[model samples]
Target: MSRAEELKQQLKPGQVYRREDLTPYSNAVDRHLAQLVTEGVLDKIAQGMYYYPKQSVFGVIPPEDEVLVRSFLKDDRFLLTSPNSYNALRVGTTQLYNKRVVYNHKRHGEVDLNGKKFFFCKTPYFPKKATPEFLLVDLVNHLDSLAEDREMVLKNVIVKAKSMDSNKLKYAVRAYGHTKTKKLLDPVLVQMKSKAHVH
Candidate 1:
C-alpha cells in the first residue's frame, strides 16, 4: 500500500482529529490530509480539524460534541455547557441561546467548529461536570450577558440560593464564582449564615 493509503487506514469513523494527530501516520501530513479530504474519507470540520464520519443505516452520523471539542482543544479537561441551560434553574431566565460555552484551562474566546460557535473560557478551576450548584454560580457569573431583566433574575437567585444546600452553594460560589458573582452571592450567603445563627 502507498503512504496515503497507510494514513487513510489509520482513520477511525466518528473520530475528530487535529492535524498533529495524523502527522505520526504520514510524513507528508498536509498532502495526505488533502488527498483523504478529496476522496471523501475525511471531512474538514474547521481549519486544521477533520472528522471521519460514521455511517448509519439512515445516512451519515455527525461527530459528537464531546469528541469534536476534545480534539479541538486537545485536552479532555473542559466543561461544555450552554447559557440556555439556565432556564432549567427556573430563576426567571427563560431565553434560549444558540451559544455553547466551554470552560477549560488552555484557550479563551470564540471559535467556530463544524459550523457551531463555541465560546472558550479559560479558568484556573472548573468541575469535571457542570453540577447544579456550578450552573447556578455560572448563571450569576454571566448574568449581565443574559437577555433577561438582570435585577429580576438576581432577586430570584437569592431566593433559589436560600432553597439550595448552603454549604454546597457556598462552595460553588467560592470556587467557580467570578468576581462579580462572588460579590452578588456574598450577601445572600451571609444572610443565610446569620439566619442559621438565629435558628
Candidate 2:
C-alpha cells in the first residue's frame, strides 16, 4: 500500500500523528504528504500534525492549535480543561474571547506557541474526579477572558446549572469542592433563581 493510502486509512479527526509513526513506511512518505498538502487532501497543521481540512468547516479551523494542545497532552498528564472546554461549549460561534488558551497541566507557568499563548496554572488540589458542573465552570472561567463580563457569565452559568439534575449538581459541586470559584458563581446562581421565581 502507498503512504497516501495508509495515511487515509489511519487518519481520525482530533488525532495527531507524528513523524515517528510514519518512520517504517517509506522515504517517499514526506513527498507524498507534501503532495497531499498541495492537493488539499490534508493540512499540515503544525510541526508534526496533519488533519483533513474538511473538519474545520464547522467553525474556526484551528488545526494547528488543536495539534499543539494534543501534543502538550502527550508530554504531561494534563486535562484540556479551561479555555479548551470553553471553546467546546461555544463550538460553531465566532464570538468567543479566548486570547490565550489555558490548560490545567497539574503544574505551573505558561508557554507560547506559534504566536499563541497557553497558560498552565498549577493547582495542588484539583479534584481526583471531575463533575459536569465543575467541568462547565472551568470552561466558563477559561473562556471568560474578560474580567468585566463576570455577571453575564454567571447568569449563563446559573441557567446551565439549573438545567442539570440535583444529583448531578451535587456531584458536580462536590467534585469541584468549596473554592474561590463558588464566590464567583454564587451570585449568578442566586440571580437565576430570582428570575425563575419572578416568572
Candidate 3:
C-alpha cells in the first residue's frame, strides 16, 4: 500500500499524533506528508501534529483542546484538574472561562500545545485533592448534558477524597495555598457536607 494510504488509515478525528508515530508503518511518512500538504489534503496544527483539511467543513478548523490535552499527557502523567476538570463537568458545551487548560503535573509551569494553552501545576500527590465546591461549580456549568445521577457523582467525589494520599493532598494544599479557587469552593463544600450527613 502507498505511504499516504497507510497514514490516512491511521488518522482518526480528535486524535493527536506525532510524525514519529508514523515511522513504524513507513519510512516515507515525511515525504507523503509533504505531498499531502502541497495538495491541501492536510494542515499542520503544530510542529508534528496534522489534521485532515477535508474534515473541516468551513475551512475554519481549529486545534482540538482534548487532542492537545492527550498530547500533553504523552510527555508526562497528569491529572485533569482545576479549570479543566471544571470544563469537563460541563461536558457537552464549550467552556466559558477564558483560562487555559489546567493540569496537575509532576513538573511545574505552563506549556502551549499547538495554539492551545495548558498549565501544569506540580502536585506531590497522585490522586489530587479536588474540593467539593470547585467540583460542584464545574458540574453546574455542565449540568445541561450530565448523564450521571447527581447523588452518585457527589458520592464519587467524596470517595475520591477519601482514597487520596493524605501527604500528597497536604503538599498540594501547601503548594497552591489559599486563593480564589478555595474561596469559590467554600459554599459548595458546606452544601456537600450537609447533603452527605442527610443521606
Better of 1 and 2 by TM-score: 1
List pairs with backbone clashes in candidate 2: none
Worst 10 residues of 3 by lDDT: 86-95
Each candidate: RMSD to true structure?
Answer: 1.5, 7.6, 9.5
Candidate 1 per-residue lDDT, tens place, 88-158, comes to 88999988899999999999999999989999999889999888889999999888899999999999988
The predicted structure with the larger lDDT, 1 or 2, is 1
lDDT per residue (tens digit) for residues 27-62 in model 3 = 788898887677766776678767653356655455
Point out where model 2 deviates above 4 Å: 1-16, 27-42, 52-95, 98-132, 139-144, 152-164, 183-199
Residues 142-192 of candidate 2: C-alpha lDDT, one tens digit per residue = 434544356665566666777765455554554554465666566656665
Q: Which ten residues in a row have the lowest lDDT in candidate 2?
A: 85-94
- The Cα error of candidate 2 at residue 181, in Å, is 1.4
CA deviation > 4 Å runs, candidate 3: 52-63, 75-77, 81-97, 126-199
List the candidate 1 regions with Cα displacement exceeding 4 Å. none
Instruction: Report backbone clashes per prediction.
Output: 0, 0, 1
Local lDDT at 11 for model 2: 61
How far residue 48's Cα lies from its native spot in candidate 1, in Å, is 1.6
- The candidates, ranked best first by TM-score, are 1, 3, 2
Output the TM-score of candidate 3.
0.51
